[model samples]
Target: MIPLTEEQQMLQAMVRRMAREKLKPRAAEIDNTGEFPWDIVELFRENGLFGIHFPEEYGGSGGGVVDLCLAVEEVAQGCSDAAVILAGQALGSKLILLSGSEEQKRKYLPRIASGEFIPAFALTEPGAGSDNVSMQSRAVRDGDYYVINGRKIFITHADVADIFTLFAKTDPEKKARGISAFIINKGTPGLGIGKIEKKMAHKGNHACEVILEDVRVPRENLVGAEGEGFMEAMKILTTSRPVTAARAVGLAQVALDEAVAYAKTRVQFGQPIAKFQGIQFMLADMAIKVEAARQLVYNAAFLADRDYKSKEAQRASSMAKCFATDTAMQVTCDAVQVFGGYGYMREYPVERLMREAKVTQIVEGTNQVQRVVIARALLED
Candidate 1:
C-alpha cells in the first residue's frame, strides 16, 4: 500500500465519503437519462474539488497531481462520469497553467479554479485522432488577431465550456511543428456547437463537436509561441496520464468490490459461489490486479508531482496509463463473469462498469500508442 501524508489521507476520506453518499445514488440516473449533472458540478465546486491541484495564488488549494489523482480515483469509485467532470477541469486548464502568459493565467486560472467557468481542450478533429498532426484546422495571423477555422470533434464539455484551449496549424507545411495553441472564448464570432455525441459510456459528461469558422482570437491569447502547441500538448498529456490511470484504478477497484460482495452471498450447489475454488481464484486475481494497478498509478503521480519533465516520469506515466486501463478492462470483464447472467443485465452495476472501463484504454492515448511512446522513450539517449 502506498503511504499518504496526513493531508492526503484527509482528502481521500472526505472525497470517498462524498462519492459514496452523494454521487453513487445519482450515477444510474445520470447514465440512463444522459443528463449533465449540474448538481454534482456544484458539489465539486462547493467542496473545492475543482481547484485541488492548482496553485493557491490562483484561488486553488495548492495541491499536486497526486491530490488530483486521489480525488479522481475516489470519485470514480462511485461514478466514472462525475470523475470525468473533475478531471476534465484539470485537463482543460493545464495548458494555460503550463504555457499561458502571466496575464492569461491570472485571468483564466482563477475562474477555472473557482469552478465559475468551464474550459474544454479542443484538439481532436474528424481526420485527426491518433495522428493529430494530420489535423486540417488552420489559423491565419491577421494583424493582432488570428482567424481560426476548424471543427473539433469529441471535445469534452464543449457545449458548456466558457473557455477553450484550441489547437490549429499556423503553418500547414510544417505539419506537427506548425501547430499552435490558442485560447478562444465561447462567444467569439462564428464559434458554434455542432452535434452532441450520444456515447456508450460517460453519458453525463458530454463530448461534442466544436465548430470554429473564422473565429478571431487576440494574439495575446496564444499559448506559448506558434509551432509549440503540439509540444505543449504532449507535455501536459504526460503529466495528466497518471490521473487517467487513477480513474482506471478506481473503476477496477469498485468492480472487484461489487464482485466480491455478490460472490459471498451467491449460492450454487449447496454452498456460496465464493466457496467454490473457481470463484475464489477469480476474486483473488481481480484483487491482485487492482492493487498492482493502484501502486503503479500512485508511483506515476508521485513522479509527475516531483518532476514532470523527466524522461522517467514520462515513461512511467505512459506505463501507468496503459497498464491500469488494461487492468480495468480485464478486471471489469471478470467481475461481470462472476455475476454470470445477472451481470449482463442493465439492472446490475457490473455491466455499466464494464462499459466505462473500455474507454479508459482508448482515451488519453490508446494502449497501442502508449506502447509506441514507451519504446521510443527507451530508445532515446
Candidate 2:
C-alpha cells in the first residue's frame, strides 16, 4: 500500500469501516428494491464525502482526486451502486472547480460540499453520448439571460438534483467550439424531468433524462466562456476517469474476495474447490488483475491530484478506466463460475455483483473509446 498522511490513512480506515458496516449489509436490499439509496448518500454526506475532490474553503476536506479515488474504491468494495452515487457528488463538484470562476466557486461549491445542494452535470444527450460535441441543446442570448432548449439523456440525478451544471451550444456552426457550460437551478421554469430509467445496474445512482424547453438562465449562470464546454468537459473526464477506474477495481476485488472465501469452504471431489488447479488459477488471475488495475487507477489519480509533470496523464487515465473495467467484467464472471451451479441462484450475491460489473466497461467512455483516446493521445504527441 502507498504510504498516506495520518489524516489520509484515517479517512481510508473510516471509509472501510463505513462500507463494511453500512453498505455491504444493505447491498441486497438496495438491489431488490431498485430505489435510490438516499440513506447511504446521507451517510456519505454526513461523513464529509460529498466535497472530497474540492478545496476546503468550499466546505470540503481539501482532499484531491486520488484521495477521493481511494474513498470511491472503499465505498465500492461494499456496494458498487453506492460508490457511483458518491461519484455524482465528486464528479459534479470537479467540473465546476475546474471550469467555474471564483464567484461560481463561492456560490456553488460550498453548498454542494456541505450536501445542502446536490449538483448534477448534464452533458450526455440521446444522440450525443461518445461524441459529446454533437449536443443539440441550444442557449440563446436573450437580454440579461440565456434561454436554453433541448434535452439531456442518461444524466445522473436529473430528477432529484437541486442544481444542474449544463452544457449547451451558443453557436451551432462552431459545433464543439460553440458549446458552453451553464449552471441552471432545478426549479427553473420550463425545466422538466423525463422518465426515470430502470437500468441493468446502478439503479441506486438514479439516472434520468432532463428536458430544458426555453429554460431561462441568467448570464451569471454561465460556467465558463462560450465555446469552452468541450474542453471543460474533457478536463473533468480526464481526472474523473480514474475515479471510475478505482471503483471498478473495488468491484473486482469484492468479486475475488467472495470467490476465494467460497472456494475455501465449498466441497468438491471430497476437498475444498480451492484445491483444484482451475479454481486456483482463476483466483490468481482475479487477484493479479485487481492489483494491476488499482495501480493504474492510483497512478492516474496521483498525476491529476499532484499536478504531475508526466505528459501521459490523460492516456494513463483512459488506460486505467479501460483496463480496470474489463477486469471487473472478467473477474466477476469468473467469480460466478467458481461458485458452480450455486452461483446462479438468488441466494448468492455473485449474480448481482456480476450484473453490476458489466456497466463499468461501458460508462465513462466505453473501453473501445478508451482505446481511441489512448491512440489519439499517442499519435498527437
Top candidate by lDDT: 1
- In candidate 2, the residue pairs with backbone N, CA or C atoms under 3 Å apart (3 or more residues apart, or in different chains) clash, namely none
Leading candidate by TM-score: 1
Off by over 4 Å in 2: 308-311
List lDDT for all candidates, in order.
0.93, 0.87
For model 2, the local distance difference test gives 0.87
Tens-digit lDDT string for candidate 2 (13-80) = 99999999999998888888888888987898789888777788877888887888889999999998
| Shift in Å, residue 325, candidate 2 | 0.7
TM-score of 2: 0.97
Tens digit of per-residue lDDT, candidate 1, span 1-381: 568999999999999999999999988899899999999999998999999998999999999899999999999999999999988999999999988889999999999998999999999999999999999999999999999999999999999899999999999999988999999998999999999998999998899999999999999999999999988898888779999999999999999999999999988899889999999999999999999999999999999888888898999999999999999999999999999999999999999999999999988889999999999988885
